[model samples]
Target: MTPSLPDILVGNFLCMAEPPPPESAGEFMAGKVGVVALLSLLAAQEAERGPSARVWENAAIRAVLTDAAEAYGDAFAEAGAGVDTDFTLGALDRANAALRRSLIALHEAVETAGDVVRDHAILRLYGQMADARRLDMPPLPGR
Candidate 1:
């Protein structure tokens, strides 16, 4: 079976990691992986669909994606740094957290939208974001 886009993207991100404490590094890597996957997914969607008329019509969705894009960019920029310091890791974590929050808002807006095409497109993007987040989550202890 073919790997999904999020899986492929996360795999690529994890491949480049140099190894660190499992607890801290796992969370950090997961967050970075999710951000990279989400950004790539968003870009691909926009590229395939072009600028959506619906996105411009709905201020909430537009704002959500705009803010998310910015946060994702910030996180992506910091992703290459060595995770040797708590400061660096924390910065990336905050950025990814912001991005995730914005994405949730975007998904909510899209779900309530009346337009079928716009809803479908946004829903797909939202699903990808969710998948990325789930992929990056730390494993349960003793499970």
Candidate 2:
């Protein structure tokens, strides 16, 4: 059976952590290994969830723009009508970039119009987006 990427990463981390060399640089090497291990774990998490998060965020942004269309105009509607057909990380990232640009424009328009309700709604979505992308990173050593 093929080992999953996360499992493989963790396995490598374990292997690398053991049998520390009996050299003066052993501690330094351990520190470096710890950092790499932490990074590997984070990458594992991203590999599992990053794509879905982007897709969800894209849909969410589109929904917000669609709702704003009545107040904003056809441009808002057109931007919101975008759908994600490609699931590749690069494609998702590119689409996210485009949608976020539109979101920025929509937010600016709303702010300029003094639409407090819409502005607050966009702000809330921004918070949600940040929360969704958050990783469970471990604290660094020695605070």
Candidate 3:
């Protein structure tokens, strides 16, 4: 006999545990359904896009940093220094945030000067910072 929703509810309410082994008819239909399949598909999609999205974001940041470094000369040397490190999704994320904040200053400085070369370069950096911020991972809560 197929289990009913009430039977399943009695067995595993609030994700307490697996539904009881309902030997009777009404209990059989009450167990969880294709949750595994849905979860599997979602996991696969996240795995595929996760790395490439981060890499692409890093590439965009790199392009902006490289340009700004050239334009600013030696001022941003340290900014470009550790940026090339092999960062996990987490570390790269933190750095991405800092870069975004830095882009604000870069924009202000370049905007006041109106130098075509620096102006255009800073524009690229601004766009990149915006893109990076959008792609940035969410912060983890303190344990």
lDDT for every model?
Answer: 0.47, 0.86, 0.53
Best by TM-score: 2
Which digits, one per residue and each the tens of the lDDT, describe model 2 over residues 1-143? 73444566777768676776668366788786786778787777878888999999999999999999999998989999968999887788888988999999999999999999999999999999998877798887789
Per-model TM against the reference = 0.29, 0.77, 0.45
Candidate 2, run of 10 with poorest lDDT = 1-10
Q: Select the stronger candidate by TM-score from 1 and 2.
A: 2
Candidate 3, pairs of clashing residues: 1-25, 2-25, 3-26, 3-27, 3-28, 3-29, 4-26
Model 3: CA > 4 A from native = 1-47, 83-87, 121-143
Question: How far off is model 1, as Cα RMSD?
Answer: 16.2
Clashes of each: 0, 0, 7
lDDT of 3 by residue, 71-103 (tens): 665545445445436646566556665765665
